[model samples]
Target: MTDEASAPGKSTAPGKSTAPQASDQYVQSLARGLSVIRAFDAANPVMTLSEVAARTDLTRATARRFLHTLVELGYVRTDGKSFVLTAKVLQLGYSYLSALSLPQLAQPHLEDLSLALGESTSAAVLDGTDIFYVARVATRRIMTIGITVGTRFPAYATSMGRVLLAGLPQPRLEEYLAAAELHAITPRTVATRGELLAVLDKVRAQGWCLLDQELEVGLMSIAAPVWNHNAGDVVAAVNVSLQAQSVAAQADPAAYLESVRRHVVETARAISQDVSAKHGDA
Candidate 1:
C-alpha cells in the first residue's frame, strides 16, 4: 500500500509513461479514479472525503464524484462520514489471479516447502517496482505485516525481487535501474543503483538470492527464480522466510542457512518443471 521505494504522489503503474498527461491515450479521469482507489491502504483503510482528496492530490469535488461512483458500483461504501473499500473490490484482483496459472501451480509446492522447512514459503511476480505475492504457505507469523496473496514489497530490498530482477533481460533491467527510486527500507537495504547492480550480478551468476535483514529487522529470506517452459526467462520467484534467531540458534549457522537455501532452490526447480510440463501439454 505505502511502499517506501515509491516516491510521494507518483503512480506505480507498470510501464508508466514519461510523456505528458496531454497525450491522446492518457485518460485523466481514469487515472484520477484509480488514484482514489489506491488512496486507501493498510495505514489508511478508512478516510473522509477531504482525507481522500488530500491523499490523492485531487480536489474535494473530484474525489467526491469518484467516491460516489465507486459506491454506486458497489466497490466502495460510505457510512455518511467515512469511506471504505468493500469485498467487491477484491473481485478486481481475482480476475487477474484466476487467469494466472502460476499461483495455482505454485500453491501446493509452497505448502510442501513450508511443511518441510517449518517456515513460510511464498511465490511472487514482478509488478512495476514491487514483488507481488501470488501464493503463500505460512507455518508461523514472522513479519510485522500479514503477508497475503496480494502483498507487495519493494523489489530492491527483497530476495524474491532480487531473483526476479536478475532474471530480467539486460535492456529491461537497465531501464528499471534508471527509473527506480532507491531508498533505504532498512539499514542493510541496497539503496544505490551501483551497489544493487553488483548484487544482482552475483544473483544472476549464482541462480538464487539470500537476503538478510534488508526488508525487516528480524526476517531472513532465500529465493530462487522460477523459469518459463523454455527455461529462457523467469516468470516468478519462490522464497522461504524465517526469523533471524532461528538461523543463529543453529550450531552451524552457515550450514543451516545453506540447507535452507538448497530447499528453496529445489522447490523452485520443481515448480519450474511443473510449469514447463503444463505448457508442453498445452
Candidate 2:
C-alpha cells in the first residue's frame, strides 16, 4: 500500500543528515530496515535481493540481512529469489489510519456521494508535495491507475491538492511554489509557477477547484476543502471525479457542474462538522 518507491536515504547535506548527533540517540540500522519496507510499491511489488539493495542504496549483505529479519518478523515473504510484502504490512498503515477519525467520519459521506452521482469520491490530506488518499468510494474505473487507501498523486495536478494548497498562507504557498517540482504530467497540467499561482488564487477565491485532464487524459474532478472547526484551518479535501466525456452526455453541462459542485461542497462541509463534533482539534 506504500506509494514511495523507497523511503529516501539520508542526505549528505549538513542539516538533513539522519545520523544521530549522539550514539545513543538514533539507530541507523532501524532506519535502513524501514527503508527496505518502503521500497516495495505498485510498480515494484516484488524485487530480487539486488533490486532491493539498489533501491535502498545498501550493500547486498546489509539488504539481505534486513529482508531476512523482516521475513522472520512476518512483514515480508520470499520465494527463493524474489521478495514481496505480505498482508501483515497493512498493519502499519492501518495503525495510522485507525488513529485518525477523519477517514471513518468521511467514509459514509464519500459512499453516499458515489452512490448518488455515480462518480468516484475521495478524501485526501497533503503530504509534502503529494496528496495521499485516506478514504475513497469508487463507482467505476476512470483512470488507468488504480487508487486505494494510501495511494498518492502529485498535489499540483489534482483538484483536491489545489484546494488544500490554496488554504496555505501566502508565504508558505510561495515557498511551496518555489521548491515544488512541477513536471507536466499531462498536456493540460499547470507546470509553470506563474500558472500554478494563478490557479491557486482562483481556488482560494472560489473555495473549490475543478481540474480537467491535468493528471490523466479524460479524468475530471471537483473538490472542496474540509475545514477544522476548532482551529479554523483546512485539514483535508474531498472530491468527486468523473470522465470528461460524461460531462457532455448530461442534459446541460452548466447544470451538471452546478449540481456536482453543490453536492461536493456539502459533503466536505458535513465531514468537517463531523470531525469537529467528534474530535475538537482533529
Candidate 3:
C-alpha cells in the first residue's frame, strides 16, 4: 500500500535529506508520510514501529501515527507485530508504467530476445542514479537478488544503467559524476569516476555496452539504448544477462561478444521502431 519514491534503489530515511521550506503548497506531513514508505526496500521489507522510526529518523510516536495513517489508507498492513507493504503499493508504479507505452511495447520483444539468447532480458529507464526495471523476461536466474518489474539497481554498476548514463548531456553527466557515490559493488566494478567516464565514452560512441562481471561476481550483460525518434533522445535501455560460467563454454568467447552485441542492439532498435511507430513519428 505504501508508495515508492522518485529515487529508485534508495531507502530515504528521515534526516538523510534536508527538509523543504514549508509553504502554502508544500506539505511537510505528506513528505514525512512518504519517507516512512520509502524506508522499506528489498533488504528491509518488514519492520516494527521502532525500526521504521530509526530508519526514517522520525520519533517513535511520529512513525506510529504514519503507519496507522497508511494502514487506514490501505497502503500498509500490520501482521501481529510488524508492518509490510501490500499489493496496493504497486498502484503507485503502475500509474507510471501505464502512462508510458515503452514497457508494454517492450514486453513481447524482451520475451523473444530472451528465448533467442537463452538468457534473461530486461528493459529499464533511468530514475535518478538508479535504473528501474519496467519489463523483464527470465530464462534462468543469474543473480542472488530477484529482479522483477519495478526492481531497481544502481546505474553505475549495470550495463543498462551505463547506456542510460551515456545518453545524458555533458552538463548532466558531469553533475551525476560529481554527486554520485562511486562505491564498489564487486571486484570488477569500475572503481573511479575517470574509469567509468572512459567506459561511458565508449558506450556513447559504440551505442552499446558489454559489462563483464561488473555488477556482480558471475553475471555479465550487454545493453543498447532505446531511442525516441520523435524526441531524438535516448528514452530507455534493454539488456540481456548471461552467466560467466555458461559463456565460458562457448567455442570462441571473443567472437561471442559480437554476437551478443548484435542481438541486443537489434532488439533495442526493434523496440525503438515500435515506439516511433506508436507515436506516429516514424
Candidate 4:
C-alpha cells in the first residue's frame, strides 16, 4: 500500500487534507500509510478490507498491512467486520492545537467578537489553495453553510485568506496567485487575476478586507491580519461573518464592514499579545 500527501479537498470528506505530493522511495511508504487513513470518510466511515483497498487504490494485502499497522498504533480500530477511526486520531489535530496554543488563546476574544457583532467569527491560516478553519465562534447554528473544525474553503474567495495573503512576501503571494484562479462560487466571486490582485492590494492598504458572498452565498465576511509584535510578521487572520440578509438589513455595507473589521482587528491584537506571547516568539 502507498500513501500520498493528501491535498485538502480531494476525498476531503470534510477530509481536512488527503492530497499529498508525489513521493520518492522513502516518502512512498509514508504516503501509502496516510492514504489508508484517508480512505475513511463521512459517507464511508467504516469499511471491509476490500472497501478500504478500493478507497485507497491499494491492493487488499497492502491496505490490510497499513490498516493493521494503524490499528496497532491506536489510531485506527476494528469493530466487527469494518475498520473505524479511534479517539487517538484526535491527537494528530490536538498536536497542532497544543503546539500553537491558538484555539485556547483565541476563544474568549472570538466569542466576544461574535456576541458583540451578532455574527460568526473565525481564525485561520493558509493551506495550499484553501483556508483551513482553525478556530470558530458561530452565533447561529443554522447558517447558510455548515462549518466545522477542519473545514477548508477556497482562499481566493474569503476575507481571511485575502488579509493574511496581503501580509505574505511579494514573491510568495505572487506564486500563490499565479497558481490560483478566482473560483466563482457566486457571481460576486472575483474570477480574474487582475481583480483579485486589486482587492488584495486594497486589503493591504486599508488593513482589512470585506468579502460579500464570494465563497458562500448570502454570507458576507470581513477580516484583518494578526501580526507578531516581535517579528512584525502577520501570523494569521481573524474574521467576522454575517448573514447577507442581515448586512442588507442594516442598510450600509461600508459601516458594517468597518465595524466588523475593527472587532476582528482588536480581537486579533489580543490574540497576538495574549496567545503569541506564550509561544517563544510571541
List all candidate RMSDs to the true structure. Answer: 3.6, 4.9, 4.2, 5.6
233-277: candidate 1 lDDT, tens digit per residue: 899999988778878999999999999999999999999998888
How far is 92's C-alpha from truth in model 3 (Å)?
1.6
> Which window of 10 residues has the lowest lDDT sum in candidate 4?
1-10
lDDT of 2 by residue, 123-142 (tens): 99987677788998877667
lDDT of each: 0.81, 0.81, 0.81, 0.72
**Which numbered prediction scores highest in TM-score against the true structure?**
1
Alpha-carbon deviation at 141 in model 1, angstroms: 2.5
- Summarize candidate 4's per-residue lDDT along 1-282 as a digit string, tens digits: 000011122313332344455656457777788777766644466789988888777788998899899989999989756899887887878878778776777788888888898877888888776677788886664243356556556677778888888888999898788666455666777868888888888999988888776665666777888777777778778887766777678778678767777788888888888755776554
Task: Give the range where candidate 1 is weakest over 10 consecutive residues by summed lDDT.
Answer: 1-10
Candidate 4 versus the native: TM-score?
Answer: 0.77
Candidate 2 residue spans exceeding 4 A from truth: 1-26
Per-residue lDDT tens digits for candidate 3, residues 1-282, read: 011111222323322444556889998788889888877766578899989999888899999999999999999999858999888888877878899999999999998998888878899999766788898887766676667787777788889989999999999888777656777766778968999999999999999998887777777889999998887889999998887877898999888878988999999999999998888753
Candidate 4 overall Cα lDDT vs. reference?
A: 0.72
Q: After superposition, how far is residue 121 of candidate 3 from its true place, in Å?
A: 0.7
Name the lDDT of candidate 3: 0.81
Order the candidates by TM-score, highest first.
1, 3, 2, 4
